[model samples]
Target: MLFDGDNDQKNKFIDHSMWNRLINDAKTPLTKGVHQFQVDLEEFLNIEKPNSKRGDLKPINVIKKHVSGEIAMDKLEELKAIVHGITSV
Candidate 1:
């Protein structure tokens, strides 16, 4: 019943596609350097629990385990490459 409304599925699909595009496109330096996994993890956590503090126990633990230590630029480039590979495939 979550997608009970008319066009809900379509809307969700579009929303996901837009999110993918935003995460994958590397035109902006800020966007290019962030890891997609990080972005996805954030999204997952946000949906699983809304309005939770970033440093809250659950979210903090999740981020601590998955967040990278690499420099931002390096992480961005890696994400760009991953997106490129996915698009090419």
Candidate 2:
């Protein structure tokens, strides 16, 4: 099954697509001033801090959260939460 697939090139596109949507959404605001998005982003990164600390995972480990399936639901939610970190929401 494709689910079992592990093509690095294909996975890079998937990761970019996912993160770009979020990064674009959480990138800027209508007003020119400090924003909560930064703080929320920090919190979001902290969620994955454990995996980061290990230094064993790939640089694009967020993509793995997808391969992990629903087992990584909370991580997805954290991603959503981070995307909403922008004032646009």
Candidate 3:
């Protein structure tokens, strides 16, 4: 399983802060900005999936991995594009 330890290391990544704001911001309904949804999304990243590399498809983990330089440039670009699309809306 992909590991995100309990040290709050995500603070070291710029994208993590961006996502934290997006998820927690009172204006966005992306995940309703609610406590339960926040918890669920975090837990959801830990669930195993078939036919895919670990943490490859999870957006939450993607941000973490991308910011940590664990993922590819193309993947990062893809994520940026997606973010651009969302923020542009």
Candidate 4:
């Protein structure tokens, strides 16, 4: 027997696998904390969620209220460490 599939099938498979891996790996607090920080960063950048058209800048503006220069630098370092750890996996 022979089988055939389209690009969409392959893309979906890859996406599903990648998402599963990410979810499984996020069980650790270090990974979960970094992932949450990334989500917050996206919100602070006024990024619209998938399929959303509106961009709200209020969250971006509020960044300064919660983050200072020194704290920002420290967070940057933490982000880098998290990224490096993920990539090495």
> Each prediction's Cα lDDT score?
0.41, 0.41, 0.44, 0.42
* TM-score list, all predictions: 0.26, 0.29, 0.29, 0.28
What's each prediction's clash count?
1, 0, 0, 0
Model 3, range 1-89, lDDT digits (tens) per residue? Answer: 12223332265434544554554454545532233123333343343333336545566664665467766666557545554554552
Which portions of model 3 miss their true places by more than 4 Å? Answer: 1-64
**Lowest summed-lDDT stretch of 10 residues in model 1?**
1-10
Identify the leading candidate in terms of lDDT: 3
Where is model 1 more than 4 Å wrong at Cα? 1-14, 29-32, 42-58, 63-89
Per-residue CA lDDT of model 1 for 2-89, tens digit only, reads: 1111222236336654555544564454332333443344343333332455435644554454465322555456545666664542
Worst 10 residues of 3 by lDDT: 31-40
| Model 2: pairs clashing at backbone N, Cα or C within 3 Å | none
Error of 3 at 50 (Å): 14
| Ranking of candidates on lDDT, top first | 3, 4, 1, 2
Once model 3 is optimally superposed onto the true structure by TM-score, how far is the C-alpha of residue 42 displaced, in angstroms? 12
**Better lDDT candidate (2, 3):** 3
* C-alpha RMSD of candidate 3: 12.5
